[model samples]
Target: MSTYMAFVYGILYLLFTTFTFVFEDAYGFTQSNVGLVYIGIGVGMLLGLAVLGSASDKIAIGMAKSHNNGVIKPEYRLPALVPGGFFVPVGLFLYGWAAEKHVQWAVPLLGTLLVGIGIIVSFMCVQTYLVDAFTVHAASAIAANTVLRSVFGAVLPLAGLKMYSKLGLGWGNSLLGFLALAMCVVPFFFVRYGERIRTNPRFQVKL
Candidate 1:
């Protein structure tokens, strides 16, 4: 689940990094204007982290309380992904097609904002889930997740130009949105079967 979350994060970064060019070419945004637009993403991410990060803990505790004995399962963290899963693709679709159609600049910017919120929400949930699931070996789990997503982030941008050129922003981002949509299944799977999966002997680690 963490790996899949990282992969989506990679795609989100790819879309974000390339948006400068997209804004300039498609909407004729000046460099300063583009920078201002980017501030929206930063602000969105900050708010998302603040809200969702704390919410995850509250949710886990609530779930634990519901269990009578107050034992929290890592799977409880996954419900946070629900809002993110729905919004990420919606934001991507809006960003891509709005840009492609040259809709009002605010339209795409709103999409960017949603994308920012969605990505951070998903990221926070995944990180929390991994830490809760691998209490003793969380460092290794996070390191692996970081490495995989970093590779995707580094490499995927190289194709951004060609992808947008051939497919146009609409289809290119739609492709990404579709991928993100598919990744939503990861959390659902974990929510349903995570405890059983964690019971495997291979997952056990000494502190």
Candidate 2:
């Protein structure tokens, strides 16, 4: 899951690294205005965090109640990934193509909003799931996740210029969108197999 988040975040940051130049070159915005253009994304991120924060707890608690043991597995925190996975890819495509086509600047801004929403939703889910799954070692799990996320976050953006330069924003981001589409399967995989993996002796042996 951390691996999944790493790539998703890296892909999102591609826009983070590139959008300022996009606004200037495509939308004819000055430096000061570029910051203002990001407000849509900021709002979208907050909205996602707010909605998912409440929704995730509700879902986990509801599922826990349904369990005969009255215990919630970490996987219960993952259903939100279903929607989150969808949002990232769709948002990427929307923003990428809108910017590439030079449609109304607002169109791309709307796309950025979706991207922000997807990113925050996914981020929260991953963090919560890790914390639950590794209760005694939650800090270690989170530290590992954070380290990998940071590595990818720092490294992937470095590729942004070459990627956008060669593939153009549309296809470059489409490549990321497709990668995100592939990652959508990860949550389901974890949900179905997580308990087994956690309990498996060989798995623990490997660890």
Candidate 3:
């Protein structure tokens, strides 16, 4: 589920990182101005990480107190993913649609803010969840996920111009919106039945 959320968040990161050029061109903004928009995303992300990443641990640990189960249930880590999942598509759609329509520049700016918040929240959840769920192997797990995602992160921006050109912002972004919707289902699957899959001996112990 954490990896799934990362995939969704990763795509959004790609969307914004690649397509900010759209704002720069559409609004005829200066590079500094455009850089400020990117900076807003960076600032928003840092704020989220500072707050939510630490808070979620408190939340999980607090919830575990009631169960008296010495064990921290992976389910406790899920609440954070919920809002993060909801916002990614909404932000992307707003950003793309507003830009395409030539709405006030702030419309897209707001969308960027939402995208920033969503990505931060989702990432923190995934990182914290993986740390909790895997324990001894957590560093390896994070490293592995980081390597794959970093590769995607590096390549996705290069494709953005071609994709946006071919599809136009509306459809190109709509495609991403659809993908986000698909990603939203991942948490539900994991929350509903992921434990069974993880605990199955055949699945858990492997070469």
lDDT of each structure? 0.83, 0.87, 0.73
Query: Tens digits of per-residue lDDT for model 1 on 1-207?
Result: 767777777777687677788789878988888878776567768888888877887888898898636888988988888767767888889988998999999998888888888878888888888898988788999999998888888888788888888998899999988988887888788888998999888877655
What ordering of candidates by TM-score runs from best to worst? 2, 1, 3
lDDT of 2 by residue, 1-207 (tens): 999999877876777888788899999999988888778778889989899988998898888899836778898989898878778888889888999999999988888888789889889999999998888789999999999999998999999999999999899889988988999999989988988887888756334
TM-score of every candidate? 0.93, 0.95, 0.86
The residue-level lDDT of candidate 3 at 130 comes to 74
Residue-level lDDT for 115 in candidate 2: 79
Of candidates 2 and 1, the better by lDDT: 2
Reference-based lDDT, residue 168, model 2:
92
The C-alpha stretches of model 2 lying farther than 4 A from their native spots are: 205-207
The weakest ten consecutive residues by lDDT in model 2 span: 198-207
Q: Sorted on lDDT, highest at the top, how do the candidates line up?
A: 2, 1, 3
Q: How displaced is residue 179 in candidate 1, in Å?
A: 1.0
Say which prediction, candidate 1 or candidate 2, comes out ahead on TM-score.
Answer: 2
Model 1 / residue 158 / CA error / Å: 1.2
